[model samples]
Target chain A: MTVAAEKQPAVDRDVCIEVSNVTLRFGGVTSLADAGLSLRRGEVLAVIGPNGAGKTSLFNCLTGVYRPQEGNVLYRSRGGREVSLLDRKPHQICRLGVARTFQNIRLFAALTAFENVKIGAEIRQRTGPIGAMLGMPWVRRAERVSDEHAHDLLAFVGVQHRSNIIASALAYGEQRRLEIARALATDPEVLLLDEPAAGTNPAEKRDLESLINRINKELGVTVLLIEHDMRLVMSVAMNVVVLNFGRVIASGTPAEVQGDPAVVEAYLGTPADGGDGDAAPR
Target chain B: MTTLSAVARRARWWNHARVRRIGAYVFAGIVVALVTGPGGSEGHYSNGLRHGLLAPRVIPFIVGGLVVWAAVELGGRQLYRVRPLVTTVVSGSQRRWQSPVVRLVSYGLLLVVAIVYPMHISEFWRVVAANEIAIYVLLAIGLNVVIGFAGLLDLGYIAFFAIGAYATAYFTGRLPIHAPFTLNPFLVIPLAIGLALISGVILGFPTLRLRGDYLAIVTLGFGEIVYEFAKNQQGITTGSAGVFNIPHFSIHLLDINYDWGLPSLPYYYVSLGFIVVVMFLFSRLENSRVGRAWTAIREDEVAAAATGVATLKYKLMAFAIGASTSGLAGVLFASKVGSITPDAFTLQYSILVLVLVIFGGMGSIAGVALGAAVLTWLPELLRTHVNPQNRFIYFGMLIIIMMIFRPQGLLPSRRRAREIRFAEAGLEGADALGPTPGSGLTS
Candidate 1:
């Protein structure tokens, strides 16, 4: 058995999301091919790959933004009902408890921080049109509760002080944090973080790690992170999935994947003279 | 503990709510007494209110006006509550049943007052109030769809108004009919509407991709085009001479000949009915999935599409729906005026409608209605009591004042209110930019 499989024995059988034989073609280019990964509940799985490894495309397919010509993305809902993620709409996937943050923040800039978060909760809001229009008791109550919840979520991401600020006014780091909070407001079963630390400073990166850890441990939310920062991913993720040329080259513990010869070849393009630095940790 | 502070905070808001409720009751009581009590006398307030209710043309206006105010307030509150500038404290949990009930009761009261108003008012005052209100209501509703729901800034919507009026004239005027083209005046309404829809589609198709200021400019161009068309199309629209002595609409049967002659009170009722129907449909559409789609697109088109909302299709839908409403209003307007002229439709009318929607509350049915009534009546009231020569100045000043003091309008929807409040708060450092430094350059 693989080291990753051995380390996660209890959750090894608890695979809630499985991406198998997924191949994506963009005209003449192949974005992803035969890439397979399993995400279990209450686990943080990091997808680390080179620049052109099609990490974002994989995310898009998993979130139903794209349909791969040949692949099956099976997602097991909270109720243990298996469903195809590729068959659903993005909003439907969101409604089905799969929320994702974008690599480039996608916030409603004109809206206040509170409103930005509330929009994530809009799909789950129980009030009907008449209720919203008339400001009926039920709608009003729901809105108030949602507003408070949004505030709490913002606080969770350390942006509570900026609650009334317009989203566009926020700094880059704050905006990224706000996006995460907004995604969390949807109350997703699994949170997908796309390059959460891309433009963040070192201090902000540490905070992000703690935030993600807390969310996974305390909130009991599963996490699927796609990050380019190798050190951060190696430090936090329980299992690591590495991709090269849209295909999975290695899947195991961080240490095991780190030492793989294929991963070295994928990163350095087949090495220099006889693989002298093949096992180097750099 | 932290729980104690939370409870205390809740208690404070509860106290504020109590104070607000008491204040509302006191204010309502005082106003009611002032209007209905003996000391009020038969002066401006009494006359205005009575005239507003009694005139056949005015009754619809009164009902529509009140509805507009309520809608604006609701919309403004929602929109403003989210703004940083407005530290809004949400009070007692909203009671779902009370809102609809309150709206229904308010409308019913307005209708009742309208029906009984003429019994105690002067006929001339009544006629003036009624006529102004109905026309403005139609204009406001049409503009609301474009500016409010679609988030399109149209500086020349009045062109559609002109098109409908001219179409009516060409069909029903003394122009020579090549064949057996005699049709009922009521039928002309549908034809006018159809023509307006086609015009809207023609205009909207190319302009849908334009954003904000650019779109406004294009629409302004279209409005000018319509006006110019009416002025130059002498062979069809009688040019600047304009179509005159156009016959009032009538339905003739075997026994009853229902001729709605000149003063056009019956026509007011027809306009009222049409406004109500449109208002109902607008409200429904605003709350539907389509309405949500429009708002989503308005907020962020790229994000909306990422979420599976078809942006182009919905934007076009907004243009089509908004224009269609205006077309319906146009037909009513043409029928009521009983004439067609290029002078009737102008950029001024478009600006007036835009002002009404903005002053009332964008994307709010009731707010638009209120805006329509106020702007409509204000000019006429000025013409009668105030200086007629400086009426334009007064309106321009009013628009400026509304923008500065109550940008969300008298009865802004909650959402609009929140936006205005947010903008006012200078949340995004927008205020720091300080009064649009290059404003003159853009103008």
Candidate 2:
């Protein structure tokens, strides 16, 4: 159940999220079995797996969409407060500064791209419902701030030009970018993207990689993504966790995972004749 | 050969757009003439084709066709250019009236017209129509919150109206409970609203998880339960006999005191005031953060939840606010009529209000208000001309035709129009959170 064999990556920065031996089950199905991983404060970590390998389930557990029956998902805010994410609702977790994009793009389709991002920024405003209705001075100010922030995020993700167009009407790649912009609008300490480049072309995927890099390197926000594309995973992620059969089979630098016989076997179903791990017992 | 070719060319003229347009007018005129003409007169001569062409019946058809053709030529050409015309008029007015002063003046003029309307029209029935339509406008606006804003299809909205009416009766001592003191109908308004608000919560809390048709059925059942209680609650509701002698709205200020008369003017004014207030409030709610939350839930509940919106709280809030409007209308209805009956707040009333919201444009306040006024007054306007037995049939036909032509309703909100338009165009028919959001024709 432990993915600790490889030497741990250098922890020069704070750890944003710490998943401790989380296990989730639905009826008789074990969606995630004793899975654990830690996301560094400003590093891009990739969770790669084959189809039905429980990467999304693990994402759900982190986001509070699916509460793990056992173990803790902890969040460490920038202010240095460690909060248990276990009994929290999705929105509550979001408010604590964890924002995520869906595996399938879940942009508000009927809303304009600007509106979709504005809604994301809206949660950050503390104005009460009454204030919003009354258009109180502070609420008005907040709305202005929210609009500006949303526009900036859109610009950051390269979808500012499509601001007024409905999300559904956007090109597939543009919609993916808009989704990222919306997530960023939450002003999160950590951003979790579930397959951001799922349906995008190679050029768009490259843009996504650079976007993740910029979000991590420039903004210094932690980035954890679930990706299936090996090249995208290796290029963007500073650390990698490979899941096979609802468990983490490998955790290391991309090169170490590539050389790990367990990771190769999970992906290709057969070990190489000269695989280094062949010297070790299963 | 030349003569034959010329005849063929003449025959081809029927395929021309202009010729066909005129032909359509001629055909409509002939049908009207046939329908309105007196039944077959005795002593008609033989030779069917020649006699039919020469008969006196032909004159009306020919004249009708000429008149229709003239009208089309004069006006229908502009109708064909309606899209451009509307855009020009709207944009042109926008440019001309850019100042707040000009906009304010126009709004003032509209307000003056609205206030002075009943004064100029002395017809008793017309006043009654105005009063009734105003009441329905309030109801439609309330139901719009639940069905249009929150996307909760509530079919039992009239139950809140009934609750309001009964609360008015009970508070005013019209009910058999016969309190030691009777309150003014105006005084009971707040109590009635509170009662309706409570009732909304009671119904909503248990059924918030249910959606669409299931929620609709549960609300419908709630309405039926309320109706049944009002009908057979024995002495409390006075059973089917209902409460009589319900007090009218009265004001007893320091110097002046007046009791409302049975005439419809006072009631119409009050209802109009309520309608205006409700419209203002609902419109404000529609644009605010709470409104955004409601729309988010409507668009996708799971996504809304994920974004930190408490779906249950907002859903219940929608019910409370929506029900409170109906409660206000109920108090107005009980006071205006001076009587209360379970039969008055039947399932039909619920459906009628729903029809108004849907017909007008669910999320559009102006649309729903217009829908309420038009649907309520149309029958009265047509009563003299339309056959009594066929009036309902015609009404149903009109609704069906309207829905067929404009599924988004008469005055759809931009979002609703886009959703329907996209669906029709095969662009994005399925919703983003729909069961098959990822499984679509789009790659």
Candidate 3:
């Protein structure tokens, strides 16, 4: 009951996405209970927790992949207007500029790397069915633009060399990068990356860190990343939210969260002397 | 370099170059032989050792055709390399329209040939060509939906053709409904389409979950079941004896009838008109959102669905639409023939439709039309002068040779060729290395 009351925060004007008092129940099990979070524009927020911390479920709820029965998910659009993402279809939500990547890749395997990126640009196509039928000049122009933009995005992610290759044929790291590029191609104001460093080698992870930093600093794009790698979350994120058993244990800058007693208990499961905190950098 | 090492290095270089050169030369030699051989002069060869082993007339055509085919292919390759961008753009954009235009022009050419040629041909040849073109155009359009748009391999599409024919027969033949029960042939068209749609849904529902070869097998079974039912059902279908005097289409107001006695030319024009309309509709559908969804589903079903495409619904729509086209063709056939028999719709018809779709280009509407025209004309050309036993052998050989040489069909769609290239690129480098050193095959 204490956990339930502590989770729901009153809505604020700056909050772009507000998940309030959400509870996800599947039969007899509750995956997330009274879980709440708020995302804002031009902020890189990191959500860190162990396996069943309900991070992905929270992401699913925010993106309209699943509609939580108990609470509301309000997304503020690019026009400084707010709408409930739960009321819209996944594709409609995507059109409203919320894009995400999967922890396990879900690319179009049979399509070329370029085509996979192009599908993300489907919502941006200006041509109607009639234009495509007639091969109208306007449609052709739009197609050229889309292809150029797709190529540029792939290059930004350093996978442009594999543009014509089928997506399934790419190396694992390249595929991961391609997925991110695809998400970016949707031209979303906010990007959600799930485990960007999960299977990446050290060299690739370093590159991913720089990429995330560039996306935040130069592009001014809001990034909400759920990463299990603590070093990545601590180093790159401006703010960190720690979760345990679907409830936020602590929320602050990396330094403040590092000192929280509850955060320690959540990570180690039981509290001991805090000396070993340096053993694994907070 | 030492003599032995230098010799070994030369041998390695020779092996690589030799294989390629041999392939090229062999290809060229076949072409040259076909062009210069007796076919050019219309000479005949007689072999007393075995009477059935050779046919004088056939040998010339086959050899000459091969030579012409090879020279064109070699020329095309050289042209492609010399002006890559021009060829790519021309081939890409023009390929889509080539089939329909080619078909229109070829029909005109045939008309000219018919008039100018010194020798007089039989009336049956004209009938055969007209019927073949009409039926094939319909079949190609039907198949264009399943294979071209939806990318579903349907090996037994002829079942719908049989369904259409049977529906026409049952309605106009012996159905004891009302007083004397004679449905207008025009009315039977819609009825046939409706029946085919119903059958399409029935067939599609169970096999919706199936993909690739499994789906093909289930469809083949469905066709066989339909065939067997027609064969055994004597009370309704009249069994193997079939129904007779089904009645041809007539317009009393226009004063047209079997006795009004229009020549086959009028029927040919009508068929041509229908083919044009179908081509227009197919072209529109191919470039629409529905077509893109079909291509997306074909490319990746899971990704398509994830992008908010209703994959199952679109696929079923494809099947139903395709079956309806076949049904429409069947109605025409039944009305033209004035009778219906199960023999008219067989596995061979299904394969023939598939061959037409493939020979044109799977996803290209114009290619399908061209394919229909060529295949239709080829048989007629053979039957006019060649032996019946050898006609099929020639046809089979032609298909085999085409598959080996030009798997993409005569006028391969640019989009489909790109897809094939992408697939080949993925497989080529890995397969050529010939399994790892420790692999079972190498060991």
Candidate 4:
């Protein structure tokens, strides 16, 4: 892993998203205070912190759920256009090649697993409502393509066997993988996972780790995740950022951040009360 | 310590056989009194205690109450003993109906019945009664798209109906305000649809941002506003008197003239044709990308948005499409009546259509059609035989009983049935239900 990192020229690696001094507040309480980070193309980056750290808030701001009061979130489109992501809607961000999953699984509970993945491809569907209402051949062909693509994504995420099952009926680990498959169906250039390994056993976590690695390496999609699982963050992420309260405490390679004193203090200060079970000192 | 000793004494008293036996007799006596209370059947005929204990009504009620109480006590004991077996059998039967073939055959048989219905009926009933049922079915299906599929609880769906009716009035030169030229009612159908579509967008664009009950309140206000506008705009709508003598739906082509005149036959066929077309289009929309997007938004708007489903756009689309169906029905209504009135497009009409949708399964096309037909026909059937005051009471009781037993619907859409079952099973969120069949992209 270190050898590949050393071989890649720093100047050649493109930055996909740049968060510059972004500040977000909910009334008097500040959730993110002048926080900034950059996600490089085709790399796995993890944002790790204790409870109440602005990790999930940073993800929300990037996805346009909450607008930052100051600074900008800028994205480099595949066509090499610099697009400002501020004032844009969440779906607009998704259309511009950003996809995200919720911290708590938010699958379409009444829809089948196959249908859940198909909804992700809706952003890229060219057929309009009129064409669909008319049941035109072109619309049918597009639907067929979407169906096949959804199945492929399900298989890619290793949940194809549960395709016919309702999303809510799936095992917890399967729901997590299905959510990832649904996100992938959007053809996103950058994927954000909010606590993707949460509530999973050791075996499921190992499966998730390899899946994230495959998504990053084989598919060449950029990933930015908010995770409390240190094993996942240390093993999978090439870059890690540590947050405490509402600010970034340290940012570097996973090994470098792990060795930082601020990171240690954030995690080890009150393991019994403040730290999440997974993030506590082991 | 005194409170504890008091509780112990109460427990000992409750355990005594004579006290238990006396308690049962008192319970039976209270039930007897309740049975002959003021709200009872024969209470209306009697003043107070003037009727003797041996009076015909008094004796029957007293005896019947005791018998019912004893049966209930005996049955409760037996049912409690076999409740586990009963619960398993009920769940097992519910699972059996989940099979797709049973649903498919039932739907097919229903379709065949609907197609042959107008043919077997009398001319008067077919032209007047059946035509009305067909028109209401169209409205119910339209509202179902918004409330059922899109999960937008629209309470002002009748506003679209009013717009459609008024559009026909204006285009046919029936309104007092202004008319560029009179157009054939058939030709003006598209204009009426367009007007309703614009109104839907106007209502949806601003209010779609609000969710659940807030949206419902706004739509309710919107319906009232439309009604008031039609009732008060004397210069245009003629106020309560309404526009009159709207031309019959007709056509003159290739030296042949066809008029949907007073026989009501042509109007019946016309409404049926529209119903068939709308149902086909709706089912197609339900099984497509648009339908999936609507379902996603309904379940979780934030997740749907994050997944690239444009939430507002789909909501508005559902609103407009739902409005279009009501517009068509309104046009048919106008042509049939040869007049349009503000009274016809009341809030009651909106609520009636909503009831039909809920009575039938919301998301199921066949279910709404059945609901509309049954609701429309049942009232008409009761009108001649039953007392007018009692008819509404009976209808209310029936609806309450329906909701208690089958909250999902008579013929539930697969997803809705599972959702209701999950809720019944003490699940916290609707999202906890297992996999439902028939959520594919194809119909």
Ten-residue stretch with the least lDDT total in model 1 chain B: B433-442
Fnat values, one per model, are 0.10, 0.38, 0.15, 0.82
lDDT of 4 by residue, B389-432 (tens): 44675577668879898887767778767666767775423531
Q: Estimate each model's TM-score.
A: 0.60, 0.85, 0.65, 0.85
Q: Please give the lDDT score for candidate 4.
A: 0.82
Ranking by TM-score: 4, 2, 3, 1
Pick by TM-score: 2 or 3, better one: 2
Stretches of model 2 off by over 4 angstroms after superposition? A1-14, A26-28, A68-71, A271-282, B1-107, B178-181, B427-443
Docking class of 3: incorrect
- Ranked by TM-score, the better of candidates 3 and 4 is 4
lDDT of each prediction vs. the true structure?
A: 0.72, 0.80, 0.72, 0.82
Per-residue alpha-carbon lDDT of model 2 for A1-282, expressed as tens digits? 233433345442377899988888889999888898888888899998788999998888887778889989888899989899988877888889888888777776677899888888888667765676566899889888988998899999998888999989999999988888888888888989999989899999999889999998888889999998888888999889988878988887887787777877777676546544543211
Off by over 4 Å in 1: A1-100, A103-193, A196-282, B1-98, B118-131, B173-180, B253-256, B427-443
Model 2 Cα displacement at A57 (Å)?
Answer: 2.3
The clash count for each model shown is 33, 0, 0, 1
lDDT of 1 by residue, B250-337 (tens): 8888987988776645666667777777787778767554566566556555455444445556677676666666766766666666
B1-443 per-residue lDDT for model 2 (tens digits): 99999778877967666677787887776656544443332343234334445568777787889787876776787777787989999889868776869966875786577678878776666465545887898999999988878878888999999999998888888788876767898988998899999999999999977776778889999999999999998789998987888888999999889988777877888887887777777777787777877777777666666666677888999999999889999999999888887898799999999999989987878788888888888777666664454456557867997889987787787776776776777764233113223322111
